[model samples]
Target: MAKKLSSAQLQELAIEKKIKRRNFISFSAFFIGAGAAFGGWKWLYNSPQETAGITAGTRQPLRRALNKTELFFRRIFSNDHVVKTYPKERAAKVVRVNSDIGMSTDNFNAANWQLSVVKKNGHVLKIGIEEIRALPKTEIVYDFKCVEGWDQIQHWAGLRFVDFMAHYGLQEQAEMEYVGMETPDGAYYVGLDMESALHPQTLLAYEMNDQPIAEVHGAPLRLIIPVKYGIKNLKRIGTINFSNQRPRDYWAEQGYDYYSGL
Candidate 1:
């Protein structure tokens, strides 16, 4: 014997099943719509060609936006980002000194060369190569980074920048904002931040690899600031000036970060 439901009961059961199917259909449609929208948005926003066009067309506005972004990140990070250092055994071989913006002239005379250190109150102090050699010398095998996406490790020998400043009684002048160095020919010049200039590894190098600096290597004296890009390390440093205002750098004028430090 078979049992049969009433017509009304059968209609109710059918309605319930129909409602469940409709609900499921609605949910599936909603999910598909959301996925399509997300995909479209990503396609529109994440195109490199579009970004490049925007930057090239609206350079000033884009530059401002970039500056704001950099400032925001820098503030958030608090200057704590440090470059990675390696052991001397892992150091890379010295590469060619790529830039010669300030080294074009050969008019530098080692015998007549003198390094000048200026005081805030307009007093000037001068020292000779012998004076620099008199200070305790330190040698370091460290990496040199370039702003143009390259790096090298080399052996450097010289008096540490802090030691040189200490010998000249410039340690207390911490308020100084810029350290400027010029080649003997006055063609090549650089400006550095006080922090980078006085970094423990920064050196006013007179020698490289246990030998006196070669003429091509900015001999008599050159700055070996490991914390900054190679461009900031001026060779043949004939004049060292401490300034309250930001000093003019050769590369910054040609579009580079003014505070190009590690």
Candidate 2:
């Protein structure tokens, strides 16, 4: 048999039970409020209207966040951080070609192709492919990274972009913050920072794998900027522009990052 509690003791026990119940209720409310906040945040993150602009595709908020993160890193990035190179023996015999936006040259005449450089001062210089080839050639064997989660170790031979700029007396123009390039028909385009453009390994490549670059692989002239992802390497480049402002980028406009660095 249990002894009955005294009145005072019973009162104290009832108070204790009430306090415990209040604590439990408070805890439950806190958790519910926290959960509601988290759920609201998730909904806002996925809200297209809330996060819509230039980067408006699948997962807009995440893409925008990544772009901001990449830009922040690029701001503190080092020019000395070069892409690693491998021995020529490690180069791929045949590199895969993707993105066919600018590859179609059915009516285009390679012989008449000229690389046009537009300076910040509105000065334009039309340079022939032969003139570009006449410049000293720089060769590199490095990993060519693509944004599609694939990469290839390839050998590229071309005139250094810095050398090309110097040859054309555009060193001052090269100091611009951005460099923009596009295909002849304006089918595709890319923008680059001057730092990547001036990297020692970045090239206006005319040869690949110890021979002249085949037509299928950006022949005549193409950008071979190892510092950036392969997409920034505009192939069969027809126009080059230097700008103090951020230039328009094809992939960036399509919900990709403007600074597609390695």
Candidate 3:
């Protein structure tokens, strides 16, 4: 005959059984979740490819998903959703230099830099740096985010894009669907929706950390938009054009999202 167990022994055995059952369920759940993830990844890997914004290719399903995400961000975006600014003390002392595709010119001259702005009337204005500086100056110290999983608090000063439009008599541009900007040599470019482009925090920045922008850091003029990842904060802006069609983006052509909003 089996030995009778005391009350304490019976309770201990019950607890042991309960723990084993719980562990088994937990392990089962983990495997199920992992299997689902693997299936999704495998499906994405085998998906059909399609043309990216420019010429690079991307999975059709992934591209559609990215577009949907872009639309969602666009729907919820508003001028009131401004990025918060911090005190200058919170900004980094040594700003990071990530890409130099546009600023790699050996003979690039900051003083002679001219901004080519395409007006709605089909006229191109070759604007000097002084013209940009003459506009009212606004400064912001905000978290400068990057897509590479890093960020820095930066102090930037420039002419607000909205104010820039009013100054240039280009208020009509705010009504456009998109704004496209590129480096002088056309090595780098980015596109922004009209709302993000005309946001109060967007700027045609000429200074960084209370000084003239470093040449490697986009120099005489660049763009400062806090609401976007660093990829959209174009450097060394050479040409700015208003467009009804979505502009071709350098990164987007490389399989990154066309609308790389924060």
Q: Candidate 1's C-alpha lDDT?
A: 0.73
- Compute each candidate's TM-score over C-alphas: 0.68, 0.79, 0.96
What C-alpha lDDT do the candidate models reach, one value each? 0.73, 0.85, 0.89
Best prediction by TM-score = 3
**Better candidate number, 1 or 3, judged by lDDT:** 3
Clashing pairs in 3: none
- The alpha-carbon deviation from the true structure for residue 99 of candidate 2, after best TM-score superposition, in angstroms, is 1.9
Question: What residue pairs clash in candidate 2, if any at all?
Answer: none
| Candidate 2 structure quality by residue, lDDT tens digits, 99-216 | 7788787778888988888877787899998888888889999999999999999999999998888888888888778888988878888888888888888899999998988877
Could you tell me the lDDT of residue 238 within candidate 1?
79
Sort by TM-score, top down from the best: 3, 2, 1
